[model samples]
Target: PLGYIKSISFICYPFAYGNPNKPKKMSELEKRQIEKGDLSCLINNQQDANILYKRIIKLYHQRDMVYLVKPKTLRYWLKSIALRDANEVFRDLVNSGY
Candidate 1:
C-alpha cells in the first residue's frame, strides 16, 4: 500500500537516500583496513588515501553516484581526515607546551 497522509495528523521527514540510519556491521578486517587507510593518509600515501571516502559514498546515494565508492571505504576516508586534523591540533598543543 502506498503511504498516505492523514487529514489532521501529518508526518514531517527529511529526504535521505539509502538506509542512513542503519547500523553498520564492520568486520575485523574491514576495521583494520580503515585504520590502515587513516595511517596511510597521515603518511601522505595518496594511493590508498581515498579508501574510506569511497566507502562513505557507498553508504549514501549521493556519494556513490560519481565515484561509486563503498560505504566501508568512505568511512575510512572520513576517519583519516578527522585523524589528520586531530594530529595537527595535538602537534600545535605540544609545541605550545600545553
Candidate 2:
C-alpha cells in the first residue's frame, strides 16, 4: 500500500523529485541569452517549469484577494521586471521601442 501511494505521488508530482537527466552546465552563450531577457532560458526542464508555476500561483494569491487578475498577467509582469533589470543595452532598446 505504501509503495502504491508513493508511486501515485511520484506520478502526480514528478517535478518534486527533480530531473536527473538535465544538463549540469549551461554554455556562456546560454547564460548571456538569459541575461538579455530570454525568459524561456530560465526553465531548462520540467522541474524548473513546475517550480516556476508553483511560485507564480503563490505570488498571485499573496498579491490579490479577488481572482481578478490572471496568472498570465503576473507572468508578463515578471518578464517585464526581468527585462528591465537586464543589461543596459537591452533595457535601453526595450524602453525606446516601447
Candidate 3:
C-alpha cells in the first residue's frame, strides 16, 4: 500500500518530505560518554546522572535497538551502539526511562 511504503521510507529516510530537522551532531567526547553510560563515570550529582541516563536512552531509541539487560550488559550494548552506528541521534526514549 502507499501508506505502508511511505512509512517504510520515513523509517529508512527520516527526511522523506520537505522536513529539514536534521539532528544535531554529537561531539566525539560527548558520544563516547553517552555510549559508556557508566554510573561510576557519572559525577555524584543529579544533573550528571540525569544527563547520562537520558543520553543512553536516547541512543538506544535512535538506533531502533532495545537493551533489555543488566547494568554491565547495558554498558556493553551502548558502547557497541556508539562505536558502530553513525546515524543522527534523536530522542525517542521519552517516558520509558530517564
Ranking by lDDT: 1, 3, 2
Candidate 3 residue lDDT tens string, 1-98: 01111111111111111223544333456444444544332322346534533222222424333322223334534657654432323233344443
lDDT of 3 at 88: 26
Reference-based lDDT, each prediction: 0.33, 0.28, 0.32
Report the CA-based lDDT of candidate 3 relative to the real structure.
0.32
The lowest-lDDT stretch of 10 consecutive residues in candidate 2 is 8-17
User: Is 1 or 3 the stronger prediction by lDDT?
Assistant: 1
Q: Per-residue CA lDDT of candidate 1, range 1-98, in tens?
A: 11211112111111232355642344456444443454323323234646532112212223211111222233434667657644754564468565
Worst 10 residues of 1 by lDDT: 5-14
RMSD of 1: 18.6
* lDDT (Cα, tens digit) per residue for candidate 2, span 1-98: 01110111111101111244542343456334334543332222246534543221111111111111122334534667545433433444457562
Give the C-alpha miss distance for residue 81 in model 3, angstroms.
18
**C-alpha lDDT of residue 48 in model 3:** 59
lDDT of 1: 0.33
